[model samples]
Structures are given as C-alpha cells and as structure tokens.
Target: LNAAPGWGTRLVAGAVVVTFMASYALFRDWERFGPLLLRHPTLLALDTLFGALLLVSAGPGSTLAYVSVCTPFLAGLIYGWRAAAVFASLQGLVLLLVHATLDNPHTGPAEALLLPGLCVVAGAAGSSLRQLMLRFTEATRALTEMRARLAVTEAVSAERARLAREMHDSVAKTLHGVALAADGLTRSAAAPDIDAARVRQQSGLVARSARRAAAESRELLADLRRESDPGHGTDVLAELAARTRDFHARTGLTATFRPTGGPAVPPVPPAVARQLLTIAAEAMENAHRHAGATRVEVLAGVHGGLLRISVHDDGRGLPPGTDLEQLRRTGHFGLIGMVERAASVGARIRVGRGTRTHGTEVRVDLPLAALTATTREA
Candidate 1:
C-alpha cells in the first residue's frame, strides 16, 4: 500500500539496488558462471538452494548474491523497518556461514561490513518514506472533511437568507396592509354610518394582530441565527431582567423584572431559561400592545424544585372562558405562542387575573426534573 503511490521512492530504491549489483559485479567476478563452483561446489549448491527459499531468506537472487543486502533495503521500502531488520539479520547470518565454510574464511572484515552499512541506509530511507505517506493521508482526510463542512455551512446560509427575503416580501407586506386598514378604520370611525365603538374595537384588533405577527417574525429570525450555537451558563433571572429592560426600551412600556424566591435556586438550564424568557416577553407584549397596560411585572425564581416565572400586567384581564387553542383562529397568537413556549420546556402555563390588581397574570412553572429530562431528549 505504501509503495504503490510513491513513484519517486520506488525509482530511488530500484536505482540503489542496481548500483549495488553493479558494484558486486566489479569486485566479486559475478560475470563468471559461479566463482565458488570450481573450488567450493557444495557452497554453490547451498547458495542456490537457499536463494529459492519460501520461508527463510539466506541470500538474494543467484545473479546478485554479493549485493544481497539490497534485498533487505527493498523490503524496508515495501514493508517498513521491521521487515528490513528481519532480512538484514538473516543476510548477516548467511554471510557468516558462507565465509566460514570457504577456503579463505579470514578475508578482511571491512569488505564484509560494507553490506550491513548499506542495509542500514536503505532501512532508514524506507522508514522516512512510510512516515511521509502517513502524513499525506492524514492531511488529505482533514482537508476533505473541512471542505464538506464549509459547503454545508454555505448552503445553510444561502437558504436562510432566501427564506428571510421571501417572508419579508409577503408576510411583512400583509402586516403593513393590516396597519393601513386599521388607520383607515380609525379615520372613518366617527362617521354617522360607522359605529364608533365597533370601529375602535376592530381597529385595535387589526393593529394588535399586525404587531404580534411582526414580533413573531423578528423572534423567528433571531432563533434562526442562534439555532446551531451551543448553550452556556447564564443566570436566568438576571437575563430576564435584562430582557425586561430591553423590552421597555423598545416598546416604551413600563416593564420591571424581580426575582421572587431566594438565591438558593439552582441555575436554570439554558434551554428552559430561553423558553421561559420568550413566554414572558410575549405575555408582557400582549398586555402593553393589546390590554393597554402601562405596567408589566416579570418574576423568575425557584419554588418546590421548579423554576417559577410569572408575568403580570395592570390591564383588563383575559376574557371569561378564554381558550388558548382557539386564539389562533381569531388571529391573536401571542397568548398561544406563550403557552407553546412554556410547554416546549415541559412547563405548565396559566392565564388569569392578578391577585393584587384587576389585570392579567401569566404564570409558567417548570419542574427541575421535567426540564432536565426535556433538555436531555433535545
């Protein structure tokens, strides 16, 4: 596997083998049929028989026995350092046995040492080649994965931008039309043919619906931007208070956030806190825009191992027998969205009159256990 793609390394290894073989022919009289045949026929027979070995490598091919160290060098390139070491060790053993069995067993040790030195160089080259190949594969794999993620991110961004443009063109235009209709109804409200009371009510409803739809659109856009982000440790009550102040600054309504329970409350999960804040904002907006409330109160704290959040306003309370599900049919989804938001965190929601004033009160209760379970599932 390592050798197949490395054309340069293969060519270099082949050249080294050929060079070694040429050197052997120069010094060892390799052109002769067999230098050892006349004086040591038994040695020649042993060499030939061992060269064709299947399980043990005593020497190289008969044509290049003097340069047999090249066998281990090539093996190093093909199978790395381990194979090189095995072949080199076997070659050394064979060299010792052949020289010892020859008539001139004491031939200078320097000539014998040259082959082992060449084998060491070959093994180092092979090991370096394998290391380079491994690095190339890993870098390629990382680059491919990064490209895939980049493509997905670009596609998602393009799609979201397209969707936002379409919604602004269609839904935004429709809401603007609703505002125009409400203005026209107000102008004609005092006419004799028009019942002023009914016209005012219809205008208020139209204006409120337009505002609610616009708010939902803005929240949808915000959610889209934040969808892929991970959660963080945020103080739920502090964040709610910040949002409350932001809401007042945006809508010019009197909004206040205050914690009810003591500081012993465990930190609320980010998901649960987000839903609670969204629901509270919707309730406060409902009171300010539709219920004609000047003051809205937001409370968040822990009670009975549950995260308790309540939004109360000094405005006319909900109508008798108000059904949350039916609010969508009447084109008033503010309350309905609040309920859904609370439910998303496995919380209970209730809408009723405030205990201290003649106004609406919205309470959301999120049990810690239920919120934890929902967070896990999500």
Candidate 2:
C-alpha cells in the first residue's frame, strides 16, 4: 500500500510482515539432533511441523519446550480463539505423551513444562517492529494526502488572488467613471435647453443601472473569495466537537458527535461549512425544543466523495406523512430552512426516522461537486 496504495498490495505487505515476525520463533538448536530426527523420516517431518506451529504459540521464556505450542497460537491468531484453543489442547496432549513415553535424560516433568515457559521475547520485538512499520506507512499516506491538499490550496489561492486584484481594478474603474458621469450630469443639468436636459438625465440613469449591475457581479465574486471568518476558519471536526459539547451543556441533553472516513479530511469552504454547521445546530435545537428529545447524535464526514451529515434525536418523531410539502402545512420551517441551506449549497437533504431511537433524523448529503464555486453557481 505504501507503494501502489492498493488493497492487493496492502494484503501482500501485511502477509510479508507477519511472516517476517513469525520467523523469529524458528531459531532452535536444530543442528544438535539432526541425525536422530533425520534417521526417522516421520520424526523429522514431525519436527518440521512442530517448528512451523512454534510461530503461533506464546512461550514464557524458552523456545524448545513451547515449540509445539506454535500451531495452536497460530491457529488462534488466524482462525480465532476457539481454533487456537483446540489446537493447543491437541498439542499439549501430544507433548505430554511424548515426554512420558521417552526414557531419555530430557524426560523430566520440568522438561515437559518448557512450552509453557518459552520466553518468545523475540516475538515481542517482532510485534513492536510490525507496529512501527504500520505506523510509518500510515504517516506516509497522510503526508501524501496533505501534499495534494496543499497543492490544491496553493492553486486556489493564486486564482482567488488574481480575481480579487482584477475586481479591485475593473470595478474600481467602473465606479470611478460612474461617479464622474453623475457629477458632470448634475452640474450640466442646467442644460441651457429642455431636450438636452432630458436626454442627459435618461442617458445618466441608464449608465447608473449598467454600473450597478457590474458592481453586483463584482460583489458576488468577492463573496466567493472572501477571507475566512473567525470560528468557521478552524477544523470542521473540532467545530462539531465543540458544538456537541455546547449543545449538551446548554440544553442539558445528551449529545454525541463523531467523524467517519478518516482522522483528517480536506478543508471545506468557509461559507458552505458555516451553512452546514448552522443547519446542524438548527436541527439539534429543534429536536430538543420541539421533539422533546433527550439525546442527540450527529455524524459528519466525507464518504465516497460525498459529504454526509446527519443529526438524529431520540425523542418524539414527526408524523409519517411529514415531508417537504407536508412541512409547509405544519409551519415548521426548521426542516425547510435545512432543505434551503442544503439546496443553496447544491446539496440534498433527507429526513427520516432516527436509527438510534424512534425519533427524527435529519440527514444532509452533498455531492463533492455541489461544494465547488462552479456548482454553487449552477
């Protein structure tokens, strides 16, 4: 995943890391009894299988005794605790039988306890190394995303800076010319003739209207590229958290806010963010005030290139017929305002029953396209 960023490669990387760590448990004094195990092909095969299973077992302090434990530990890790437990039981039975049947000097009860005591300290080191590698990979992915966002931000800033500069020059000049024309018209209104005065006044009014339209267009563009306002300039997740806390405190209602997708998402435009937050706040407040809700939950995140936000409450729900049209009759403009805000941002809002409880759920879903300046205009 670090290289190709695909799940196939990611799975391969995971397997490789797991194997590398699993190999640390394979180091035993295999050279010492090579002949005896080799002479008996079956024992040799058993030894090989034992070594394989050793990778999964958790040994206290020694490798030799707990070598048989690997199969169960690995089974548990791969197939879950039940499989691990079953494999461990079989391994323990075989180990006990082997030790008891052997008449060799190594056949003591304490010798049989080796699997229980194998330190497997090397495995811990392997686990730590694996964790470090995974963390580094995550950091690298995050860095890549941040770099992409930075590039987009720089490009946008440059464009906005250019537009702002052009607006200042062009609009300023237009207004300046209009002011000069108005001054000249007022001074020249003495006309010296009725026809000249009427013509000048009509011409001046047309010019004023034309200038006003140009000024309005400039204002629209200016609003698009405006500087960030105080609170909305910060992170959206943090804003949601603060809002959840404030709601709980202000209304004495239980409120929880959580983010999905990932820890850090790309920044949202300030105006859109503000409207979304306002809609969220409004939904939550209405739930508490009108729905008699005691608990509220809000989720905000961009998933599948679509921004999704949901505010759900666990109190009384709306009638089954409630909808955009039905809402107009009830005079509850809270839902209407939500729909309007979402519509203004080129979003789609859905109102339904809350999943947490049988209350109201106001969900606003905005396509990524809707959040852009071009789509906003459309």
Candidate 3:
C-alpha cells in the first residue's frame, strides 16, 4: 500500500528494523539466520553482502571500508527514514563491538570508532531524503485531484447559466405571447359578425397556452429561488400535481396527475428543477394550443438515477414539423427550449403522441448528476 500516515506503517517499519538488527547480532554465524531472510530476504541479503565485501576488499585501516554505510541507506530507500536510522545505529553498534573484541585490538578506541560513527550520519541522511520525496509526491497527488474537480464544477456552472438564458427567451416569451392573445380575443368579442365559434376556439387555445406558460414560469422561478435559498425543497410529485391542477383551474380543462415511486422531497438540484419545470410546462402548453386537448395528464417517476416527467394531453395531434428551427422562430419555440435545457443537464426529452390520449406526449428524463452540482451551491 501507498505509505499513508498511520500507526501500522510505523509499527511494521520499526519492528522490521529492530528484528533484523537483533537477529544479525544474535547469530553472526548461524544457519537459522537464513530462514529469517524469508521476512525481507532481499534487504537482508544486500546489507549482509555489502558489509562482508567491505571487510574483504578494504582492510580496517582503509577509510573505503566505511562503504558498508550502504546497508542503512538501502533500509531507508525501501522502508522509510525512521527504520533506516534505527538500522544504521544498530549496525554501527555491532561493528564497534566486533572490531573491539576480534578485529582491531591494536587500534586505539577513537580510530576504530570513526567508520561506525560515519555510518550513523549516512543512515540519518538517507532517511531525510526519502521523507522529502514522499512528502512531495503526496502534495502533487492532492493538487492534481483538486484541479480536476474544479474543472468539472466550472463546466457545470457555465451550462446552468446558458440554460437559464434560453428558458427566459423561449418559455417566458411564449407565455407573454399567450397572455397577449387571450386579452386580444376577449376584447375582440365586442365586435359583431366576429365568427363567434372560431373566436371561442382561439380564446380557449389562448387560455390553455397562458396557463401552461404561467406554470412553466413558476417552476423555472422555483429553480432560480432554490439556487439562492434551498429551504423550499419541493416534493417533485406534489409540484407536478399542483401545476396540473392550476392548469385545469385556469383553462377550465380537465388535467390529471399520477406519480409512481419518487422521493417526497425531490433530490434534484436547482439546475435540474429548472430544466424539468421548463419541459413539463412546454409539453402542457403545446397540448393546450396546438392539440386543442380537453384532458391532460402529468406523470412522474424515477428510473436509473434519473427523474422522468411526462405530460400527455388528449387532443387532435398535429404533424411533426419538417423545419423545427423555422417553427420555433415563428412561434413554437418551447419545444426547442425544452430540448436544449435537457441537453445542458445531461438529460433527454422524448416528444410523441400518447397511446390512449390521442394527442402530444412529451417526456423528459433528467440525470441526477446535473442536480449534484447545484446541491453544493445550495
């Protein structure tokens, strides 16, 4: 495992160094020491061989004999600083004792002590170098992770801003147009030979469109509010049902809502809330104006960490547009807006006629990741 700061590494490193030095001292010439090699055979072999080679090639008189200092350096390189220091100190003690008792009886105490004393310094130096490298590596790793997280955050934030702007231009503007159309139809009723039947039909369409627009506006506003104040955490199902009821009350149309297994309080972030509200409102509006529907149904559920909102209206369905962009520019802009919002948040919206409803059905599936970004802001 990477060297995490914990008691385990300290204990293991300490024990390895202490046991290795102790066993080396206990059995300088025992065959049993070979089995102890199984614990950390490579390090044990290297240290022992280096010490033996120095003893053979460089006599006690030569300063080059101190090349055996590599034993502690190797321990530090493999384990860490603390272990390296302990191993170096232990090895130096063993050398001093061996030279005093068996190898250098003719030499003065100070002369015999010089090589072992240098070994102690070399061990400490090795440990310090390893610690510095380890610290640098950890710092670099942490910095890289933080930068990657920041990049994702920035991209999500930018997407949210673009989505908000599009909703204002498309959904909000369409609602404004519907409100104007309703007021105009009501005023024109004062004129004679006005084709009352056609005017009433247009009035109904205008009223329905206005209601959908208002609901969309409210939902979008709620999302914006959530960004600044997350205290009003709405239940997604309740909000959908409430919007449907308001649609019925405003337009004198029959609208129903059914929800299947969702959280009492929507776990959606503010960004998703905005996009979901936009799609639902747009779907309802299209049904009211173009489909001439008397009944509308809103359904909501969760699937695969996504919130799916569906709006179905029972009215005469229109043909799919050949030039979606041209239609949007003329007046039917909400569909385009809804699609863009879904894309911004890594979601998808499906628009089709309902099986039983005999009118348009728009379904939006919003990803949970879009909401996760706003949750932090909240």
How are the candidates ranked when ordered by lDDT, highest leading? 3, 1, 2
TM-score, model 3 to reference: 0.45
TM-score per model over all chains: 0.38, 0.39, 0.45
Count of clashes in candidate 3: 0
lDDT of 3 by residue, 1-378 (tens): 222368755754564456558757746855665455436746555665555434443345544356467667756755677667777776676566556545545788787787788777777777777788889998985564444334334535774586689688868788788878877787678667687886888788897887777777787776667655655544677767888888888888888898865553356554455567767877887778778888888989877656778888878875766356776778867778887776666666787775654677888775554454445556
**What overall lDDT, based on C-alpha atoms, would model 1 receive against the true structure?**
0.64
The order of the candidates by TM-score, greatest first, is 3, 2, 1
Cα displacement (Å) at residue 53, model 2 = 47
Residue 349 CA displacement from its true place in model 1, Å: 0.3
* Overall lDDT per candidate, in order of appearance: 0.64, 0.62, 0.67
Lowest lDDT block of 10, candidate 3 = 144-153
Candidate 2 lowest-lDDT run of ten = 54-63
Clashes of each: 0, 16, 0
**Model 3 misses residue 147 by how many Å?**
1.5
- The list of candidate 3 runs beyond 4 A from truth reads 1-67, 77-81, 101-111, 218-377
What tens digits encode model 1's per-residue C-alpha lDDT throughout 1-378?
112347755754575566557546744874573443334434433433444231122222233455565556655655668866766666666655554444554566775566556656766676677778888998985564444334333433454566588678756876887878777786777576987777877778787778877876886666454433334333777888898999999989889888888645555444456667788878888888889898999988888766788999998777887896678788888888887665555567988985765899999876655433332332
Please provide, for model 2 over 282-338, each residue's C-alpha lDDT reduced to its tens digit, 9 standing for 90 to 100: 999999888998889989888876678889998788877667777788787888988
